[model samples]
Structure formats: structure tokens, C-alpha cells
Target: MNDKENRSRSRNETSTRTGMGASRPSRRIVAGHTRPCAECGLVDWKLDDSRGEVSCNSCGLVVEENVIDPGAEWTNHANTGVDRSRVGAPITHTLADKGLNTSIAASDLTSGGASRNGISARSRREWRRRRVIDERSKTRQSKIRNRVKAFQYIRDRSQLPSSLKEEACRIYGMLSDEGFVTGRSIAGVTAACTYLVARKEGIPRQIPDLAEKFHVGEKELSRLIRGVSRRFNMHTITLPPQFFPKFVSDLELPPETMMALDGLWNTIEPHTDIWQGKKPMGVAAALIYKAAAEGGTRRTQSDICKVANVSEVTLRGLIKQIDGLLKSIGSPSA
Candidate 1:
């Protein structure tokens, strides 16, 4: 070929190869081929000619550093799930006969990224792991807050005759600040506070009802009741039908005095057999004995005789005998 002709041919060839922008390389053309990585399980591969590296976009592991054809069972090794091979993979997702993409790039739909496939894949996995940790932390915080609010409710609702509100606030503070964080529930706390208030004010609430409403067992409620009672130094007492005995005992009366008050009338009744005329037996006995011992008389034997329909003689005789018995007995008052 002539020199001129060869030079013209070379110039034409260089111009034909040069892209619009002076020396910039043309956009990458995907070969529409796909192969699973033997190391990582990424089924997509995009070739990077400069570095001779095959990167799997799925797990981001470099599969081939300086090799060709990457070998046949490359997808069958221990690192298959971690391979980053960028070669011989379909560039775009396809719909099956059912018209569903069912592609691994589902993450792209949720998070629209520039590199829709690559960025979405990495972000989805990381976001999922982080979301799980965050959910656990949120649940723990919720439980703690609910427990605190429950105690606050108890303190607000508690009603006692005295400064029960103040007491409740104090108790709630003690429990929340000093006790276990999630130690008690709203129901349990409400029951305890209610019970404490009732005891402090001497109001009697049914135990079973309180237990049911508070969602606490009788045993636990009982414990709380006792604890509050001890804290308040309150005394509880049950009165029987024969409350007179307890009343007298509590008064610290001498044992002999108690006996005299009980048996004096009965003994006088038996002695009535010896009395003659109509007698104000009961009143006459009470008056003479009380007067001689206590050195005071609110009513005379004459009045007793008239009230009892007994003659003065019988009334006086009975009084004299009772007085003599009192002296003989050497009673404390005598």
C-alpha cells in the first residue's frame, strides 16, 4: 500500500475508535450473562477490566483476583456464600411466566437507591439486623415505663382517713427508686396501696374482692396488709358477742372487783330465801353494799324499799347483813 494511503487509513481507524468525549472510555456494555460465585452465592457478575477482580454484589466478596474462566465448581466451595465474582451474570431481572420478578433485588422497591441492586442489597441486610436490636431496646424501655406509671396510678388512687396521699407518694418513691425496676405491676401496687389506706383509716375491705380487683393472690395481699400495719403501728382487734369481759379486762380492774360485780347480784338472789316480807331485794342489796364500801349513796334504803315493794324492816335487815359480810370479808374497799 502507498504511504499516503496507509496514513489516511490509520487516521480513519483512530477517529472511528475515539468516543464523543476525547479520550474517555465508552459506557460499560453488559453481556447479559450470569454465573453463581463459588465463594459467595451471588448469581450476578459485572466485569471490571482494570483490576482483574470479580466482585459479587450480593455478599461483596472478591471471587477472582487474577484468574480467567474462574473454574467450574467455583460455586461449590466453603466460600460460595461469600464470593464477590463479577462475571457472566444477567444484568437485569426478568419476570417468569407468572409475571412476577421474584428477584433478589426486592430491597430496591423499599429503598430507591442509585445503584438500585447493589445498595439496596447491602442496606436491607444491615437495616434488618439493626431493626431487630432496636425493637428489643424499645420493648425493654416500654416495660420499664409502664411499671413506673402503674405505681403512680396507685399512689393517686389511694384513699386513707389521714394524710394517706402523702404516705402513698412516699411509698411509691421508695419502691420506684430503691426497689427493683420492674419488680411490681400496676394491679399489685394498687392492691397494696388500697389495703394500706384502709388499714390506716380503720376501714375494713373484703380481702377476696381486693385481691381480685388488684390481680393479686390472697397470700400476697395478706403480706402487704401486714407490712402496712407494721409500718403504721396500728392495732387491730375483733370484738366477740360477749364483749363485756374484754372491756372489763382492758380496764385493768382488780380480779376480785370483777368477780364481785359479776356474782354480787346472783348471791343476793339465793339469800332471798331467808328474807321475809316483800323486799326490794335487788336494789336494796346493790345500794347498801355500794354505800358502805364506796362511802357514798345516791339512794337510801327507804327509797329502795319503796321501789322494790319491800317493807323497811326487811330492807334494813338485808342491808345490815350485807354490811356485816363485807366487813368480815375484809374487802379492799372496806
Candidate 2:
């Protein structure tokens, strides 16, 4: 009986191993699943990359087809061995048409160029008229016409860099589509979006600056900003540190002042009462003036006020607040 038991155990162990005594099983995972061909029991398959198909090699049964090719495109313009390539600029929201339209070239309609193309005077006149109609047709609709005008206003008046302008235009477009801009001033919407984007991006500009540039009322701009922020579910909190870099760059303060300015903020941030109710721009301007003085690269209050767009009286109050905070904390006043 013991001999029979030992023989049964040996048979079980042999069955657990594959034909070659390998521990792994013959089945393999394919496309996150295991599927055996109906005609052939073997799992062997071939992938035809050019044809975008996967077929069982044993039975010629197709398992998958029309697979997308995931590969980079090489321009190969010069036909050289190198894989040099170029791509067009990305679509931008700042343009009403997303900058994808092809305009008829005015140069092609000129005298010398028109003659080179073998065009007669009669044809040239007709082509010129067609060009005008084509250009007008792009913005012929009310939506497109309004967008063209609004986007151009943003580009010209926002004074933001190309990136910020793009973001502002994108937000404005979204609001316009959702009927948020209906019965609302375009300049006000553009200004609000600009300020919100700048603050979110960490280089905030005051609402007054944006309003003045866009010729929108300050109260209306503020209200629009709040409405847009709520609609988009975006939280925008402006910190004094976020305004430091821009003020420092504009005033041309030394890099040493940066460390001092940061130190001052770290000292005040923990004291909620001191900073909680203060305006960010006012606090930032005060810190800049103080830091510059401490660093021996002094800038007057007038200079800081001009750059920060804060009145001297407001700046003085912020300066006093910062001084009191530093004194209480036993930190050196900067």
C-alpha cells in the first residue's frame, strides 16, 4: 500500500510540470485575455504590423484588426538618413477661428505676381472681389463677428504675455458659449478673465489695471470675476509671495532682497489676524519697500506705489502692519 501511494504522488508531480519539466504553464496572456483558436488548440499567434492585424499562426484565424499605429512621424524632407521632423504651431484659442483659416494672399493679387500667373485684368478684378467676400464670410455670422472683435480687444488691451492672453481668451470663449456673456459687456468679461488667470498663474495684476486698460467699470469687473469663478468651480487665492517676483523684477531689486522678503512673509503668515484681512497687493508693496531698504538697495515708497498701483496712504498702512508684526515676533524689521 505504501509503494502504491508513493507512485501516485510521483505521477501527480509530473502532471503539474509542463512537457519540458518547466514550471510555467503553456497558456499566455493576449490582449489582457486568454483566447484559444477554435480550429487550433495552440496559442501561437503572429502580429502583422503593416496590416494592423493579429492572427493565430497555427489556424490563420484573425484575433484582432484595425489596431492604431502608435509611432512618431518623421518629415524626411531632405530624404536623408536623419529622422528630422517639424510640426505646425498648436491651435490657439486667442483667435476667433482658432487660427486655422487660410487667407488669400494679397501679394498674389498684385500686378507683377498676377501677370506671372497669366491672369488677365478682368480675372484679377473678379479674384480681388472674391477675396474680399471670402474674408468677410469668415466673420459674417454674429457669433464669429463678436468673437473677432472681443479677441482683438483682449490681445490689444490686456498687456499680458502671449500665454496669459491665450488663457484669458480661452476662458472668455467658454463663458460666451455658456451664455454668461449675454447682456454683459465684452470688455468687462475680458478684464475679469485676465485678472483671474493672472492671479491663478501666480503673477497677479490688480483689477484696477486690467479695468483701466480694457475700459471696464471696476465694480462690474469684480462682479464678473466672482460669477465666472463660481461658474467654473475654480478657487483663486492670491498670496503676497505670488506678487513678489513681478514687483521685484519691475523695480530691479537685488536677488538678496528676495530671501529677506520671503523671511518676512513666513513670519507673518502664521499670525492670522495680522494678514487675514489685508489686501495682497498692499502687503506685497510694503514688503518690497522694506526688503529693499534692509538689503541696502533702497526704493522709495513712491516708486513701489507706482509699480504696485497702490496709493501712498494705503501703502503706509500696510507698512505699519508689517512693522508691528515683526516687532511682536522679535524679528528684525526690514
Candidate 3:
């Protein structure tokens, strides 16, 4: 062969051996890498921690089955027995310590359940001293001590749910940071926070209800609510009229009466001009009275007005407006 032809043949042979001239694409090797599924040729693969398998997302093909997982050995929750998680309880803002502080049980036995009396009296005394120290440590800071007291008062007085209580605590924390709680009564702020959270959550709690429960004046509660709301720039919308159904049910009203009231509220909902700028509770009371009267139920206007904490005059005015609107729409009252 000629010298040029011989060099060309050698170059081609070297390219083939090094896979540079191969017809098929070469696979790249990488540490902790994923490749396309052999069965479906799909590149999207998910690592299943429970089964330790790499599966195709498109075809559900098991690409690489039974991989060893190098994650933690424990889980937060399990179907069997108690959760054997090595982690502690989740952090909560409701507690003064943010639920991170360790609590020492006041039992006769040690933390490991060993008999305390079996140990030396000196050790028992030391444990007691440590417990006292731990408790006193929580109160060393005036802010923490005040938070503890405020939270306790909220717990004792408010009948709020746990989530609402936590939210109230968070709101109070913000208020304290802004110095809003410096001169204000802790009870008032706590009550106002609870009320605000309940209202935001669509729970049927009134400001006066919270004030009465927490033994704070309604004006003070209102002031705190306004201050916290403005400081946080929180604009809570008014509760929907649909909330009245669940509320009226608490009064032991008949199902038919509730149905009528629901219909009335739905009809008047779009016409916000009628009930706008009025107390929702008073409007709801009037609607219930009108619905009851139209539904042939015997609930007196006075009974509903008292239940709604509205005056008879206000109730009558709303009833008249609703009646006129219904008549204008060519619908029967209720």
C-alpha cells in the first residue's frame, strides 16, 4: 500500500478502537448518577427510598432495583408501635421555651426508671436541685416568664382550639417585639389575638365573647385587635353569610328554618349594599327572624334579637329591607 493510504487506515483503526467512530452512542459513567431505562429508553427516573429502586416515570419500569439507601435508619412515623423517631417533639410557639426545653419529671424514679431511693441521698438531692434549676432557668428572663404567664392565662380562659392558640401566641410574639405589649395588659393582647385568629379562621367567635371570657373590657380588646392588625398589616375580610347556617344550628333552630335562612342569605349576598356597613351578627339575626316568620316557625323577634345581641329596632329595620328586596325580586319573603 501507499504511505498515505497506510496512515489513513491506521488512523481509522485507532478511531474504531477508541470508540470515537462507533455507530452507537457511548454511555458515560458518573458517580451517583442515573441513566435511561433499558426497557422504555426513558431518562426520567425516580429514586424510591422505601423500596430502594430506581423506576421509570413514564412506563413504571424498574430500572435498577434494590439499591442500598444511605439515609437515616429511623423514621418520624411508623405503622407499628410508637414512632421510634430519635427526634424530639416538633417545635411549637405556644410554649414560652418554643417547646425545645427538656422537662424533668417529678417522679420518685430517675429518668431511666431506676429507683431514686436505691441511689445515694446525695444523688437524689442533686437531681432535685437540677430539676429546680431547670424550672428556674425558664423564668430567669422576664420576657419568657411573661410569655409563660400570658400563655397560661389564654389556656385557662379561652376555649380556642390548639391551632388557634398557637396562632394567638405567634401574634402576641409579634406584638411584643413591636413594643405593643409594653403597657397593654397581656390578657388583653392574648384575648385580642385569639379573637383575630378565630375570626380569620372563620370560626364563630365575637369580640365581646372573647372579652367576657378573658375578663377584659370590650374597648380594650378592640384597641389591641386594631393595633395588632395595623402593625401586622393584616386585613381580614368579613365572615361570609354562609357561616350563619352553622351558627343558627347551635340555637336549636329547625332544619327548615335554617334552609330558609340559607336561601335568604344567598339571595342577598350579591346585593351587598343592603347589609353593607352593618354589623353582620345583627343582619344575620334579622334574617333568621324573617326566615322563621316566613317558614311558619314560632321564634319571636325578641328571642332572636337577644340571641344575636342586637336591638329589636335594628332587627326590624333589617327585616323590612330584606322583605322589600324579596318583593322587588318577585320572590316570597324568606
Best by lDDT: 2
lDDT of 1 by residue, 5-106 (tens): 754554444434544675542232224435544444335456666576767654456756754544453332475466555443432211111122222333
TM-score of 3: 0.69
lDDT value, residue 49 of candidate 1: 61
Q: What lDDT score is found at residue 179 in candidate 2?
A: 86
For the record, the alpha-carbon RMSD of candidate 1 to the native fold, in angstroms, is: 32.6
TM-score of 1: 0.25
Cα RMSD for candidates in order = 32.6, 9.2, 9.6
List, residue by residue over 5-27, the lDDT tens digit for candidate 3.
75455445433534554853333
Which is better, 1 or 3, measured by TM-score? 3
* Evaluation by TM-score, superior candidate among 1 and 2: 2
Error of 2 at 213 (Å): 2.4
Off by over 4 Å in 2: 1-70, 74-90, 106-125, 159-164
* Steric clashes per prediction: 21, 0, 0
Stretches > 4 Å off in candidate 1: 1-148, 151-166, 180-182, 227-334
